[model samples]
Target chain A: MQQSESQSTGAVGARSEQEPSNGEIVRFDQVVKRYGSNVVLNELDFSVAPGERVTLIGPSGSGKTTILRLLMTLESIDGGVIWVNGEPLSHMRRGGKLVKANETHLRRARKSIGMVFQQFNLFPNMSVRKNVTEGPVHSLGVAKDEANQRAEDLLDLVGLSDKIDAHPTQLSGGQQQRVAIARALAMRPQILLLDEVTSALDPELVAGVLDVLRNIAQTTDITMLCVTHEMSFARDVSHRVLMFDEGQVAEEGPPERIFGDPQEERTKSFLKAVLENG
Target chain B: MNWDTEFAISIIPQLLQGLVVTIQATVIGYVVALILGLAVAILRRVDYIGPVVFVVFEFIRTTPVLVQLLFVFALAPPTVAPLTIGISVLGVHYAAYTAEVYRSGIEGVAKGQWEACRALSLPPLRVWGAVVMPQAIRKVIPPLGNYLISMFKDTPYLFAITVPEMMFMAKAIGTEAFRSMEAYTLAGLFFLAVSVPSAVIIRRLERRYAAV
Candidate 1:
């Protein structure tokens, strides 16, 4: 463990001096995040290559959602750094040293990342069209006419063209989540984080939201980092699955390897429990 | 000793003039309170000065509007109109209360909404203006309407500072006519007429938005 920590630090230093050597799009080097006395993520080291789809699956309190939250900058890290697209995300280089990032730095780094929440978090006051167009028109300065057109097209992609003028409060949970997906995609983010995007939906509604996500996976090259319990969906869409245990990755490989031939006792039991429950 | 219809009718024109001033004061004062209160609520979110703003607003809220009006009246130059002083003082005094209303409204917005705004990388101003304030203001309408009614009633307190509002006119008519009952009764009727309907409208709005 000590050797791995040193190696991760050395790798971060080398990468900071130059471009990301392996062309990894997102890298977490010795990142530590804690909530009061509880350490949510401890020296977590991982990286996602561009256009790769990675899913995180584990029991509650294993820091699966925390990882996505960190990447989205919803919560600050207690230690180490997160690099997105070869630039420091949680910190900025100031006078040749890494320092905690300010709001300006975080805002700039966050523009390339978009997140969809479990609760669908669509602006209740806005119509579906405005919900999808808001980030593009207001944040990115996209023209209103172009943004509206793009919103209509994206709603069509999510099978919600008819509901474009409907308010989010007027839609079903499944429909709202689809609008949220379209809203995130409207920003044209290079990285998408899904934090239990369907966990709040009813069982019947879950499949519809999952199908929208599956369609996006098939059609877009956007890198996805998802935290979810939908094992079958994870297996189908994920290029790699990381099995988390105690805030660290216990096992990581192709979904088949992790599910069919798990090496760790933790991984074997977790998969057995999940598969049995399903 | 007797109810006099002619004396009451004679005072109507003078009282009407006072009613106009009263309405003008209430409208202008309420606008100032709404805008200034929102500014206070937003400013109180700043880390370093938030506590200071909170304490200052608390000081204003705890004191009576009568004392505040008298204090401002005394401090102002004589050139400033008494009505102007009344409007400014009443506006600021009620702003202290409205600020709390806005603070609760802002806090009532869900945490997920803020996270979504940040995730979209919306600028701080845009986040508050487009997302937070719209939702917050909706939830606050009923409470703010209640404050407006309270503020209208409070306009009579301006009489202490010699502003010619409704109560001020009633008092002047009583002094001139030596009959206090009719003028005072009419002034009370005007307040009831405005306040009751406004309260009903506010109740209807609350019921409607609650369903949303």
Candidate 2:
């Protein structure tokens, strides 16, 4: 099933460079991350299958966002290995030795993954169309005309076709985030990582961005690993939900099972607090 | 202090010729400074050589420009022209200062911009040239213009190395006439004429980019 799904998306570009031995698109085997003396992710283990949608829910310091940051290579892991498409991400094979990856190796490994930041990190120096087209033309070697056309289509999909020429500073927070979404999708990545994508928006503007994301979830076969505070959106889009506590998965199951009838004490208390505050 | 109107009027052609030399040195030296400064700024970010580059630039920044001009002039071969040596020395000296200005501008860019570039898997060259440089250069334009004006004023230092710049011509006129008042006052006026307008332009630029 994963093979056929990846092949269907391969028509956009050369995405089948590596064939996964297992069906998992992303896997962490005993991964550990630290900031000084603080251990953020301690022997964490999880996996996401190809085309699967997974949401990580936890309190502020529970290491949910750290998982996404590690996958994107924004922060390096102190121990263990990360696998993407069944290939080691944090290390590379050199004369039969698994050594830490260099810049060139990391660049090759990062091609299949894309991330949407919470701050909607659009290039303020460029127009909306150029922001979306830049990665495709420069990184993937797509032709200028084709990248421009694809950018237009993406802007239309995000319901911002009229804003193709506007600067990011001119748009509202929600509009900027939609443009960010378009920019991420323009790369044709097999795995998309969303890190509290709508956390910085005004209260009234959250629904519009969520609707755009819902549209993408329904339409594409791309694998999504999302860290979000919106519980209803998580339950609506996620196939599985993981409740994290102290850098470990406390409970994991279908959304209906985890949210409806949580089994762990930590998960129960966490959900109770969230429900009351929300 | 008698003002010599006729003497000052007579030396206009010579002063203009010296002014040409001064303007040439400032423009060429500034071009070199802009390029070398950006290179130094980027090299300072490299892990192994960053500290070495920082110490070398700090040494240059602390010393006097006149001493540097003399040191290079003494070491250069006789085959090289004094003007050539003077221009090179001035360029390298100001590069140390401009490098600091560029460092602040580069650091001023938001951290998220870099993460976005990495997430898109954009190459290092494209990240700097296409995205980072454009934003960094825009924010530093006003400070860069101030450096240009400052470099123009500093051209008088080249007279010590016998570069025959404006101040050199003024001293020659004073010695020939046996009166220092007219020539010295004209030289001061020339600097004011160029610097005041440049300061105004830089102020305007600061206001415009500040709004962005």
Candidate 3:
């Protein structure tokens, strides 16, 4: 089943110059993470293919966001290896040993993965244009002139071109988050991680950010893995949805099957609760 | 004795020179404190090494400033540069207090800030340089400025080592001329001149920080 899933997602981007076909963009092999006796991610096996949109949905503390955090190399896996673009992300093989990847190696690998957080973490000291241009100009070493052009294009894409010179505090929460999305997109990452990107916004503001994301998902070829409480948006935007519970994937499938015909009793209870609350 | 005229005349050059030394010590000492304090603060935040750095600074902080200055000055080799020794002793001593100032500032930053940085996958250095330190540094400005004023007042202690700082000059001139009143009064005025305005500025800065 995993092989088939990889193969399906692999169709979008070729793996390497000589492979003639795309390999997995991200693969987690029985990964586990623990924090001082509390297991955050248990022996979890998940994979995302190039250009595929996968949304993870579950209640708080179900470890949905942890999955995305681990992939972005923000958290280390205690038990298993993670492969990004078919290379180990959490650890490296050094001197016939699988040592943890240091700062430099992890940084190089992270260039291909972009994450948008629940809180829009714009640099408060910087303007919108500087915030958008920061990662590409500093991390990727793109030239300033080129980075500015790309930032301008992204601001237009996110409907914030007029707010380029504005500080983050001046804009509404939804606008700041849209700028964050544009900042992530500026990196041109093969996989984008969205961790409850709209959870912190006002109800009216949610739609604007969601609209920007939907536009990106439909128009662009970038792959995305999102953890969200927006069940309806997840159902509409994602090709596959995974429901996580207590550090494990309890259920996963195409949105129709997962949302409409869930096999797990836990998933059904969660969906019922969310719908009732909403 | 033409006390008023002679006092006013003596101050024109000597007091200016002493003011120059006092200001120089304040600037250099504050800079050294800033750099050393930040280094010690960050070093103490590290997991394994933090305790070691904290203990060293703690010792410096708990000990008397006078004793610390004397010990540091004594530890210097006779052939060593006087300015280096003077600035180093003052800087290292006051840095202990500055480190505590910075630690509080760093802790004042919200946990959400750290979480946001982690979610962004920022390297540790970038986290400090861009996200963490900027906010932390902003918070401690008034406290840090207050430390600068305190360090300025402490410049008198350099007199013990014959470093020829402000107070040392006052003491030397008074003893040599057998008249303590005018020289000491002038020295007191110079200190008040620098410290009084600085204290006011610090209060204003405190208000600014409180607003933030």
Candidate 4:
């Protein structure tokens, strides 16, 4: 199931990962991003292997979400290139010179990646079925019946099959977030970007969303990059957890090593603060 | 000079004929305004040409409808029908205001809504046509209806183009019979009869839909 999803989406987005490139699904090479005078990401470099679940944990404004946003091409990087599935997203090679990508280039390059924002960001104008089906039908030009069938499967996977016709406004925050997850997956993104998916929910609602995500993480071989404040979710769902500080990776290891054992002072301080409040 | 019952009775049938023209002008003029206004609003979102469009919108909006009526009437070809001239004048004038209405409506949709469409990899055309405009136009329907009613009342300004709408008929009757009170009073009554209910219905619609 995971291989088929990856194969189908690989055909949709850009140059497919059918050609091997050393097993890296996503790579950011010396990436620099800035907003006015505030540097959000400075010389950041990281790579996620295909089918690995990586979690980035940090305090606010540590530039973790910025990394996800760059991968999604929601914002362009000021320096360096972002390569997804071995294709350049930030710049295209034209006549052996790197040039900034135009709109068409960016759109095509970004199809392999899907993002779930902190806010649910579901289409308020559409029903849950349409919200999930819209991208496949329009962007992928998939047949309506085929797209509808896939939407049903995804909605069922998220445990919202009963609310297919419900509008986004009619659903609870957690339900809407689940619908958002289904919508992103319907595109069959090879690498799913979860940007603090459970951060916006109420305490009770957070657990439901987390459970759905945990199931996906365990079952799918899709590469996953998540940024979250929920330490338990990070520990449970992630293959590896990276502690981020001031726009760089401070420490990273298997979740057991990062969470159970003490290492760097900054990582120790962040973990202590988060646990104390909880 | 007084409310002459005899003069009022004689002008009633002629005034009714004039009312039909008034109604036709208002309806056609509004369709033109609505389409043109929405076009200008949507087209102005393009970065390369947006400033030029906004300048043109401001120019048309700052000018008076009466002045616009006279200008279009004077410049129109002799072969054109007077009624078409009248409708076009009103259409262009109100379109300026309605264009602003559409701009505010489109912008009023929450920023997150746009980001969702973008993240879905929906093209720009699909984003605006399928997602953004649907929500925006729903919110602006009441305001759009208010402008429709305003355009209906403003049809009287068509007298400059000699289309013989209700007000033109009233003035012509007053000249011939020298009974301004009776003819003008009846015209006001007809306008009152149409506009009051239209306005109340529009207000009710605003309350019903705009609250959400």
Which numbered prediction scores highest in DockQ against the true structure?
2
A44-156 in candidate 3: lDDT tens per residue? 88888788899998879888888888877777778767778767788665544455689788878888888898887787767899888877876777899999999999999
Model 4: residue A5 alpha-carbon error in angstroms: 41
Candidate 4 structure quality by residue, lDDT tens digits, A141-184: 89999999999999999999999999999999999999999999
What would the per-residue lDDT of candidate 1 be over residues A1-278, giving only the tens digit for each residue? 99996675665566567545567999988888899999989999999999999999988999999999999999999977898988899988876666679999998899999999999899998989999999998889999999999999999998999999999988999999999999999999999999999889889999988988999999999999999889889989999999998999999999999877989999989888988987
Q: What is the C-alpha lDDT of each candidate?
A: 0.91, 0.91, 0.82, 0.87
Per-residue error (Å), model 3, residue B187: 3.1
B134-199: candidate 4 lDDT, tens digit per residue: 999888899999988888888888877898888999999989987799888999999999989999
Using DockQ, rank the candidates from best to worst.
2, 1, 4, 3
Clashing pairs in 1: none
The interface root mean square deviation of candidate 2 comes to 0.6
Whole-model lDDT, model 2: 0.91
Q: Model 2, range B1-212, lDDT digits (tens) per residue?
A: 69989998898788878899999999999999999999899999999899999999899989999999999999999999999988898899889999999999999999999999999989989899988989999889999999999999999999999988889999999999897888888889988988898899899999998889
Question: TM-scores for all candidates?
Answer: 0.94, 0.94, 0.86, 0.93
In model 4, which regions exceed 4 Å deviation?
A: A1-20
- Please list all clashing residue pairs in model 4, or write none if there are none: none
Q: What's the lDDT for candidate 4?
A: 0.87
Candidate whose lDDT is highest: 1
How much is A268 displaced in model 1, in angstroms? 2.7
Better candidate by TM-score, 3 or 4: 4
Q: Which TM-score value belongs to model 4?
A: 0.93
Candidates 2 and 3 compared: the better one by TM-score is 2
> In terms of TM-score, how similar is model 2 to the real structure?
0.94
Better of 1 and 2 by DockQ: 2
